[model samples]
Target: MKFIPFYLIFTLLIFVQACGNKQVEENKTQREQVIAVHDEVMPKMGQLKSLEKAALQKAEELQNSETPDQAKIDELKNLASQLNLAYEGMFVWMRQYNTEDGEKTPEEVKVYLDEQLVLVSKVNEDIKAALAKAEVLLKD
Candidate 1:
């Protein structure tokens, strides 16, 4: 019968521990990235509401004008709707997002974080696009 030496067993254990720690660190990094994306756009919620209000008000004024530009009014109204939708999308993401690892394995948590990143990124794009359109419309 062959027996493993104490130093060999100890070295193997250390290697395994190091690998486990590396995986944990990676998962933590991914979680932080997801949170960063969410944070980046969170503060823009108020701006979204303000822009939506301005768009609706401008549309209303155009609607009431004697020589109503129906085309422009329609455009402004559409922009307002887009802004509102984008704002709501953020809330929806927040509601669905779970920060707790719970019983999930590390691989499951990784997959979850990846999905969250994609979802939050989409929300960010929507918000940015709506805001850009609103700014252009309001400027003119």
Candidate 2:
């Protein structure tokens, strides 16, 4: 009877261990997904900066013109500011990312990464929108 209880305990422990491993693996996959989105957009940071610079230059040129198009200048300035904000958000998020190594448990890491994924995705979208607006303005 004593051996039976010990065997049952061993079996339960194994089951629990298996479940924990599965959870850890799932968390790892989720973390990778988040990182994938980040890596995809990281390179675009430089492009966003270039767009900001171009838009600012266009704004400056328009503002300095004797017959300035106030509406167009405002639009360019707004677009440039949006691009800058997006860049800053992405940069700051990267700098503040807290999950690394085994610093956080699997569940904690997953939660943090999932939130960051949402934020980075939004930032990327903002950057793209600003770029498109700047492109149209530059073409004009």
Candidate 3:
């Protein structure tokens, strides 16, 4: 059997190892971004669904009244604003995750998605808190 040169063989081995490392790094980043996206989106969706139900109920009651309580009206407006903020924030993160640029490096995309996820999650919490308060105010 013919023998391959030692340096050439070593260089090939190093190249293969580097390729594998790169793939592993890419996969780690992808998984992290996916998790972050999940955390942010699900809560926002939950907040929206919860608030929508509460608002619809109040709106229905208002329509039946000659004068809707001013506090309830204000509360509904606030809740609506919160909902829109969350909705818009979700779309922002979605754009990052969805790769609108089409040429963003995977790492850059992941960073943007991850950061957006955190910001959106915080916004979701605010929306949820606002929804809870609005529900009580409207019920009064």
Among these predicted structures, which one has the highest lDDT?
A: 1
Model 1 lDDT per residue over 93-125, tens place: 999999898998777888999999999999999
Q: Which ten residues in a row have the lowest lDDT in candidate 3?
A: 93-102
Which of candidates 1 and 2 is the stronger one according to lDDT? 1
TM-score of each: 0.89, 0.89, 0.51
| lDDT measured at residue 105 in model 2 versus the true structure, 0 to 100 | 65
Model 1 error, position 91 (Å): 0.6
Global local distance difference test of model 3? 0.64
Q: What is the C-alpha lDDT profile of model 2 across 12-125, one tens digit per residue?
A: 999989987897888778778777777877888888899889899989999999999999889888888888987897888788766564677666766777787787787667
Which residue pairs show collisions in model 3? Answer: none
- In model 3, state the lDDT of residue 39: 63
Worst 10 residues of 1 by lDDT: 1-10
Runs of candidate 2 exceeding 4 Å displacement: 101-103
- The RMSD of every model to the true structure, in order and in angstroms, is 2.0, 1.7, 5.5
lDDT of each: 0.93, 0.81, 0.64
Instruction: Please provide, for model 3 over 1-140, each residue's C-alpha lDDT reduced to its tens digit, 9 standing for 90 to 100.
Output: 34568778989999988876796577567656665645655655766766766776676678579987777666676676676666566666556555352565655655666665566566556556665665675565
